[model samples]
Target chain A: MTVMSRNDLLLFLGFTVVVLAMPIWLHPFGAAYPDLLQRFMIYGIFAVGFNILFGLTGYLSFGHAAFFGVGSYAAVWSFKLLSLDAIPAMIFAIVISGLFALIIGYVSLRRSGIYFSILTLAFAQMSYNLAYSVLTPITNGETGLQLTLNDPRYLDRAMFEAAPGQPVPTLLGQSLGGFAGFYFCAGFLILAFFIAQRITSSPFGMMLKGIKSNQTRMNYTGFNTKPYTLAAFVISGMYAGLAGALLAVTDPLAGAERMQWTASGEVVLMTILGGAGTLVGPVIGAWLIKYFENIFSAINENILHRFFDFLPDGVDNVLVAISSKFVGEGWFLTLGLVFVLIVVFLPGGIMEGVRRIAHLFDRSRRSPTKPGKATPHPQPAE
Target chain B: MFEVIFLQFLNGLDKGAAYALIALGLTLVFGTLGVVNFAHGALFMLGAFCAVMFRQLLTLETVTLDPEKLSPWGAPLEIREPLVQAWFGDFGAVLVNYSVPASIIITIPIMLLVGIALERGIIKHFYKRPHAEQILVTFGLAIVAQEVIKSFFGPNPIPQPMPTDLRGAADIGAFLGMQANVITYPIWRLIYFLFSFVIIGGVFAFLQFTTFGMVVRAGMADRETVGLLGINIDRRFTIMFGLAAVVAGLAGVMYTPLLPPNYHIGMDFLVLSFVVVVVGGMGSLPGAVAAGFLLGILQSFASMTQVKALIPGIDQIIIYLVAVVILLVLPRGLFGRRGVMEA
Candidate 1:
């Protein structure tokens, strides 16, 4: 086997360190709490997988939340049927959601573009609607599936004495809760990043990129392109499932709402906002949004009042009144404005902005004679 | 059984009319301008809010402090009078009742201006951009529009009651020479159905019988050739977008009584209307109208107790199921043209 390239080795090490140090580094932003921290990792994993399909293969599936929801349900079901072990639950989540993704990906890949999007959307909505109503027997309906006191839990019951109180998932007696769970998810996030990077650098990843840039040209060159696209879809769907499993692992509950189209759209926004098709861009995007949701949204009218008290009374009131609409309950309004600004001004998202600034700095700091060395680092799809 | 089926069919047509109206405007934009408008539903919402605002205007009340009278708690008495009713007397009372329908006059100009402003401000710049960029920008615009409305209306649904005279059900069976009162349906719902037809017919007539529409149709068929002929087709497409917004707005105005208007109503309808457009065939006007009624009727029927007993929550996903099946089997939708909405 070929040795890992020097740049790839450096990127892997850098990404792992950043993820491992999230709890420490995010302290000043007031987002260092374990639950929120776990969410950042989980959604980071989700957005990265989504970038594989949307950013890499360029197939916009609007129903990835279906797999995510399926993963959660499978995990919870495993907890109820087998044991309170994270392994079995995650395994169940991945395999079951993988099967679901395979089936959905096969059918959806039959048609391309917006039609593919519509088909996936239809399938996911069907899953959500059925899970909410008719499939109540399995999903437990609107209340969502949760660990029950009288669950069989054959493995745990047989292997060891059952613990009392609200049971939590464990890794061979070590509880996967709070910071432990965050680390568990962080490990998976690093693994997911590694897999994504390797895929991007592989020949198969190049084939997927080929389809994205020009499917017709690829087809003219005699590539079927179906298997590659389908593989990417299922891989991304499995990633979504893994993220969903992590959600269940942390919280031990799964609701049909997780599979809603809006949830799927959230991942899309993260990818686009971060920089689709880039290695670290989606992770950054996910962290930024989660930080906004947790930290920025905490700024209520009282905080705004205190912050603006230094100005003239009239000016202070006016500023607070305007700023109030972009925070707290109005955070979504700000989210909307951000979306507009990002799409209009930064089509390549935050990563593009970063690239441009970096390019300018590189140009200024170094001599202009080495022009080839300063070729702007380009995203695969772009 | 016949009466039940007939009633469900009418319900379907009522729903179908709404679907048709919204999808019509969407398809018009897609067909002529080749832009996927995620904000079309917002236009529908704006129209509904127009009626709400107009009613609020007419029902404006003035408060007076009555010094001559005092409450039991010793506070001054207060008197409230609706300004319009006080000014116009009985005529104003009738006018307030009919305000929902009367607001159509204002909804037109307001929606037209909104439509033109949006097209000119945002969509015009995105003509040559990728479909993903178009969808994202418009989706963002939709959120902005929804947020603006929520800011003004406070996110709760504002119910607009129909004219008091149209509150009761009509004896449609008797009108059809069948047994009296056997097939009763709501009067306002029937009016909405008819009003939808009037609007649809008006849009069709406008497009089919006018010189301007001919040019617009020509532009839709071949933009380059028409542009080569020195006819400014871009201006016509801009007006077409405005015209689409007007159609969607009028649909929303007439629909207020059936379902109350909320800030989120547009989003709720957004996906369903997109499904309708896709099912009808992308960029096909007649197909959109036809598919709207088809899906509407099918949806109502799927909700029947018998149907539900057979297929369990089929009613919840019948539209999506049909779309999936149709797309898999037909691919181009019910009225697809070559190279439209395809990858």
Candidate 2:
């Protein structure tokens, strides 16, 4: 392992502390609000995994939802057949999602660029359609698979009690605790983040980067790039699966909507909107988007009127009219504008903007002389 | 059983025309500009709205007064004239009665302008971006466009009826001495099929015959070389993008009467058309058309009781099944050129 400077070590410790403290710090807010923080963390984990494949390897798998949906179904099924313990259910979900990814990524990775995207999209839509119709017995179709209170849970069945008319055990016979769910989700997200960090720094991750930059160069160097890319694809898919398992653990249901192409597109947007190649960027991106979707969407006209009551009548009406387009039914329009602006202006995403700001401050504080010309600091900080 | 099969086959062709038209436009854009225009479906929706606009225009009258009102003694009541006359006159005008044909004529220029504006306004900026960005921006544009249309047209499928002459089904099966209902295909559907074939032919012939097309084909192969030759290929590509938009729009206009035009009809068709493009081999026009019809027929057949008995929900997935099988077998799609996506 490489030695790190004091500042670097402190930064690492700082990030770790934040990750560990998030659930506890946000617990009060999360408790009052219900599952907002938990959902963000889960989707953040999902986006991080997606970024590994798309941001690193440049192979955008539009069928990622297939893995996600599969993972959820697998997790729920494990609770039904094997145990209600989160560990085994999560393991089953990851393994199944990884297996599904292996098959889909194997086929899709054969093509490159738009064709590859289309192929994966086709596969995802197929999964969605099949789950809605053909695979109803396993997937439970449009109604989605729900936990039954009466299930013969091989483990922890005695610990759980059935609610009246409930078909499945609820949260291992304990009352549904908000803080517990938040912590559980936060723990998994931290684990996923660490895994993603480790993977991006590993030799296999380097190989994937090489494939992204120039596959022909890798081929010339006598490395078979397909298997490496495919492996990355599957691993990332498994990470997505883990996120899916976490979702099911939090919510205890799986629906066909999870497998839709729109869901796949959502992840891609998160990855890109954050810095695709940056480790923490996707997490931030996911959190921001989820927050917008949850919070901004809840503000109705009455709430707006209450907030702006001090203003005069005509001006207040005008303000409401203008602000209405930024929320409620017009949120998607604003979202589209945001996406376009991001893509057109900040190609490297929010992280790039952060990097530029950091550099600007660093440049202003430093000596006037160019570093490479007169000083030992030959490189501007990466 | 045979009658049912024959009916489905006709139904398949009607659907196939739509697939073929959209796929044709997509392929043209892909072939020339190397862009997979995800917003093609939105453009199709816009085209349908154009037809709706025309329909509204033709139906508009300031005051449609009735002169049949009478007093107690049966004296006829006087009626005031309408403030504004019918725009296209009445049933005596061919264009007023025959809306489909009229829509086609109007939609072509309208679609052409829309295509040009879209190419210049938005898609032009994305020319150098990655395919993912292209997809994202176009997808965003699609949502915005659809929302705009929805705001204007409302969230409903606006039905436009075919001409009375073409309202009933053709009696081809009866003339052929088969069961009377064997091939009772609608005349409008047949008109759409013929229109599709004509447009497809015209698009192909234009690309195949024109000098401008020669340059485009050259550019698609090696853009840098074509640029070095001082051809200014981007302009041609922009035009090609517009042409592609027109193609999608025209498809939407003709298709409005067959199936009512809705805001999301484009999105519903987007996935299927992209599938057709891939099955036809990316950037291959003939491949798109062939794959469109092939998948259309397969889908129709899959919906049959015979196929559904074997594989339940096969109809919903037949296109994907065929896509998977084709990809497995051919790898680069059915007609994809070698080295296109070999990596």
Candidate 2 lDDT over residue span B175-260, tens digit each = 88986765777888888888899988998788789998888888888989999999999899888888888889898988988789
Tens digit per residue, CA lDDT, model 2, A1-382: 5455575456456667876677566565442344887788789889989998998998877888888899999999998887776778888999999999998888888778876888898889999999999899999988999888777766655655534664432344553347677667777887787677767777888988998899889999999998888888888999889888888888889999999988998888788788888888898889878877766677778888888899999988888877766677666666667777887788788999999999888876674656565456665667
Q: Which pairs clash in model 2?
A: A148-A167, A148-A168, A149-A167, A149-A168, A149-A169
- For model 1, residues A1-382, the per-residue Cα lDDT tens digits are 3567999999999999988998888888778899999999999999999999999988888899999999999999999989999999989999999999999999999998778878898899999999999999999999999997889999999988889988888877889988999999999999999999999988888999999999999999999989999999999999999999999999988999999987887888888899988989898889888889776688998999999988999999999998988888777788878988998889889999999999888877774566556547532563
Task: List DockQ, one per candidate, in order.
Answer: 0.76, 0.56
**lDDT of candidate model 1 versus the reference:** 0.91
Ten residues in sequence with the least summed lDDT for candidate 1 chain B: B334-343
**Clash pairs (backbone) in predicted model 1:** none
How close is each model in CA RMSD to the real structure? 3.5, 4.7
Write model 1 residue lDDT over B49-95, tens digit each, in one string.
Answer: 99999999999999999999999999999999999999999999999
Q: Chain A only: list TM-scores of all candidates.
A: 0.95, 0.89
| Best model per DockQ | 1
